[model samples]
Target: MTIFKRGEKELALIELKNITKCYKIGQIQVNALNGVDLSIENGEFVSIMGPSGSGKSTLLNVIGCLDQPTTGTYKLGDNNVEKVSDWQLSDIRNQFIGFVFQSFHLLPGLTALENVELPLIYRGILGKERKKRAIEALESLDLGDRMHHLPTQLSGGQQQRVAIARAIVGKPSVLLADEPTGALDSKSSVNIMSVFQKLNQEMGITIVQVTHEETIAQYGHKIFRLFDGKIEKIEVLNESLKAIE
Candidate 1:
């Protein structure tokens, strides 16, 4: 559990080489990714950005082990992602990655605490241990008071925080977020970014998020821009910006 330092050289937590993905839909073939090569070290916060159809989400999925590339070598930690069986991929996702979506994806019927415990429950963690971790996760996000409220009872930012808590309760190695702030207002978006920043800086968690907004993108250490299914360029944000309150 070594955190990657700025000046040190170590194996990346995620590596993608010559990645290409194709989707066939009713006699039409769509090439979503084209030879994208990327690497992300542990404890790094990176953002992916692109125009519509640029494969930003596709790339995130590949890194999260949700989708296999049509062609490529994807090394996540120590596993060859593209060659693993479906069950192994599921296990990998559960053990190594956590996901957050724009919609927050909370179950309406469950309380915030219940929703946060879902991932642990899926892994056969039950009763006291599961509840303990879930409470800690909520407390970590400063949502301890809202733990008993349902999704509909909480504010947008609160619900998202609950979703984030659920993602982190399992203590996954990497967090893949797709437009996590897309559904929030400016203030809430900034708040969510601050939460992510705290997690990356304090908890030594690796985060890769797909975002289209430049202001939001600046929150990350490096912003990868993609076009036509290829990464066009990378912009490194200044270190001082990480001090945003």
Candidate 2:
């Protein structure tokens, strides 16, 4: 329940100015994001809420370096996203951003430990170090004993935890999540949010997630509401309610 104000304690981990994303749908230009400006500093837990086709995912994609803004300046850490080549953008994504999704996206055959090790393998990390880091990530999420379980063998909550461990194994500066708890049961959703709270507060990871549910969104420090491709308002939650223990 800590809302971060941009008064210069730390440099912004993600910054966007006048961002616009346009897509041509059947010869009609559609703006997914319209002149959006945002700043997310290090260690902030922010949530984006909006109706369908309201640009929540678009903004997250821009922040995660998955897509470039049609017109805007986006600075993620030290890289200017618009100026980077596709190859460099790929490298930047690996270096500074970790992504979690509504779907766990675990390989059906790989064990949790091996799934978590995928990122490091992509980075060409040595095998021994890769396994060690993956183990540590899973253990941090209380999945140490489940390391050998395959995706189908684990429960939904356990599967999502595995996805999260895989996302953070490389220690990215920011974690971008799209409907992270959307597929879980209520109790499982609460567990996932608590895990996110721990990661944001204890590990100092900046987390930005898009969720449609208010109860889930309340876990964030500040909720940014979007409407028709523009940010409607910023709601600072009631801080007295502490993060779920």
Candidate 3:
């Protein structure tokens, strides 16, 4: 449970300045994000909390490189997000951002190991090395024995673990999760949160998650509350729940 300290020691991994996102629908403009400014430091676990339609998901997309902002600047690592080409943006997403979603998003037909291996395969890694790394990622999440299980064969929490392993197999710099535990039961949600804590604290992977639940949001070092597409306030927590043993 450590709040992110400001000043020079904290290097910014995600920087947003006057970021805005708008969508046009039937002659009306919808503002999903309005002049939002944010900074997430390396190794920090931050949560964005808001009601539905508050732009949390849009903000997540901008941070994850899934979509570009309508205006303002976004800097991720050394790349200026607004200035990068689409191809470069694709590369950035592949190399720097790991995404976890509410839905497990596992392929029903693939085994856990195979699903985890997809990212490495997309990067064109050799088959043997890919298999090794995928197995290692699953083992890190204590899913080593479930490597051969299909999504249907696993429990909800186990399937989420598989999804997490898949997200992390490429060793991306930042993990972006949107309602990661929204679909899980209380016990499973806590398990997923613990897994996230371990990843952020031990593996040094920076995490930014969007959640509506207060209990889930407390897992992060800082919570950003959003209202009507604008950030209402940022609260630094005293401590995150200690990583589950």
Candidate 4:
């Protein structure tokens, strides 16, 4: 029941209450998440970090609406995501969540602009408008010159920029990035993180990123440390830094 100011209104972008996710493998039951409660305010940058098998990915899946919790409740804005039907869930995901993967999931045949336009096409936007917006998004990402290039012709960083252009073209409520720099080299990783930081600070986009790298996590305003299926600690680093006298 936490509220934050968003423009003229008070709103919460994401809310999770007593969330639990479990899996049954043959005779053994494994708990992936155990009664986790979290709330992310609008326009906040958050990072979830943990070791392998620490339920970090599970938590991200639940937050992204890609997977459901075994128990507890999740609300994205005012919508009860936990109760939504599969079709309805898909609709919510399409309209609300934008996801970026480590692998840069770009269509092989489509050019950069075309790949960025894919989500708009699925939403039934006309070709002209879609292309306009796609081009604008690419241009914003400094990929205007590369719009006609296929993914195979692009560098790793360029491909990822294309993926980011695709993610943002629809103006989704939350940007969920899982190890966005995992596949990039050190230089490319820095560039990608710089883009993320600029997006958060300048555009005020709500970004929730999951990463194992501490350097990457420092970019977030808040860090949630996960361990053994639970959130062990939550640190408000920006606030802490301000408090240091």
Candidate 5:
């Protein structure tokens, strides 16, 4: 049997080796990422935290296949992302990754149900099946009653929930969230964190979130602190404890 199947050190779903990204700003060269090495296991919930210009968002984008590293290799479930074509990368991203952003990113004109169905449409799923899965996803997030509502009709939290439902409907292997609770109030933030915890624990979905809030980062199983484009520290939280109090 494969070591991965046996749950050994081999179950790495995302692996980064000496990853670097550099940007050229006129005559100046800015290094967004600098030889970062990391590994994320299947079904793990991890949070990335750092200050501005620390490359937290850059790392997230690299892991999500939204951007390519200038050097080094990124492997997602054994596929070398650095070698793949743009079309191939797009296919892989659509197949294995779901993304949640701070802005919600829902369509203004479409109803919540229709917005959730967009991913399915990209995968070529039919109308009936798409609607069915979309409804199921909305119900899972307790947004069943808001299915017919438009983005402007819902509250910020409700809109974010709709975005989350849309993200998970495709059943991707990893859910990449960038500042998911950035736009929410305290109560809504707690509710969203609870939902993320449930998804990570019950659904066995790998979650990688980037956030600047310490309170929000505490919800993750493991926390990686980034500084100046490199990882400075990592902390593992005890599952039994609610917070590191």
Candidate 6:
């Protein structure tokens, strides 16, 4: 697979053109996203910030191809994700997008390595190859020593790292994290942010994360501030806070 270099003339990995998402709850119509236009270039570390009902999660869902927009276009890589069938969207998500949630979401029954191997199992990877990749993924997050531990046995930050390992084990082109650090303490959050920075700067993975904490948002190169279901402003940081190594 070809990795996107920072200065190369690569197309936007995620492009949202006038995207909107509306949900009808009985008699009430809720607009989660309203004509939001956004673009995330390859190898970029971008953060989305907004208050409750601001459409941060909705936008992340649209970008991850997990949910379709009500109108407008969503281009993931070169594919128009909004036009794809549900099955095709699943394929695109499995092959191109990785997701991390606020809740660690690691299975209590499965060991860290086993949990990371789950995605590859769905892809029909063989046992030996799957094990190898899963170990590498865990190691990348400095979780090599805890690969055999269950989620309940690890710390909050360790569990989150395991979740991240699971997300990246598939070699997805983009990682969409929704409130990834919400459950961790300050030190743990910094550790996770450092891992994200290494992945973005060294491995060239495109990272789009939704964070409510301003300190956490400072880790990204750019911040998209959303309000009332639309992007109100974009702030480019002169210098992003370096993740603790």
Q: What is each predicted model's overall lDDT from 0 to 1?
A: 0.89, 0.88, 0.89, 0.86, 0.88, 0.90
Question: What digit string (tens of lDDT, one per residue) describes model 3 on residues 71-178?
Answer: 999877655777678898888888778999999899999999999999998799999999999999999999999999999999999999999999999888889999
* Pairs that clash in candidate 5: none
Q: What TM-score would each prediction reach against the true structure?
A: 0.95, 0.94, 0.95, 0.93, 0.94, 0.96
lDDT of 4: 0.86
Report the CA-based lDDT of candidate 5 relative to the real structure.
Answer: 0.88
Of models 3 and 4, which has the larger lDDT? 3
lDDT of 6 by residue, 159-208 (tens): 99999999999987789999999999999999999999988888778899
C-alpha lDDT of residue 52 in model 4:
96
Candidate 5 stretches greater than 4 Å from native? 1-10, 241-245
Clashing pairs in 4: none
lDDT for each residue of candidate 2 in 185-210, tens digit (9 for 90 to 100): 99999999999988887788888999
- Candidate 2, residue 140: how far the Cα is off, in Å: 0.5
Candidate 6 steric clashes: 0
TM-score of 2: 0.94
**Candidate no. 6 TM-score:** 0.96
Please list the residue runs of candidate 6 whose C-alpha ends up more than 4 Å from where it truly belongs after superposition. Answer: 1-9, 239-243
The candidate with the higher lDDT, 5 or 6, is: 6
Q: Number of clashing pairs, model 3?
A: 1
lDDT of model 3 at position 37? 92
- Candidate 1, RMSD to the unseen true structure: 2.2
Residue by residue across 24-110, what tens digits does model 4's lDDT show? 999999999999999888888899998999998899999988999999999888778897788877887788778899999999999
Q: Model 1 — TM-score against the truth?
A: 0.95
Q: After superposition, how far is residue 39 of candidate 5 from its true place, in Å?
A: 0.9
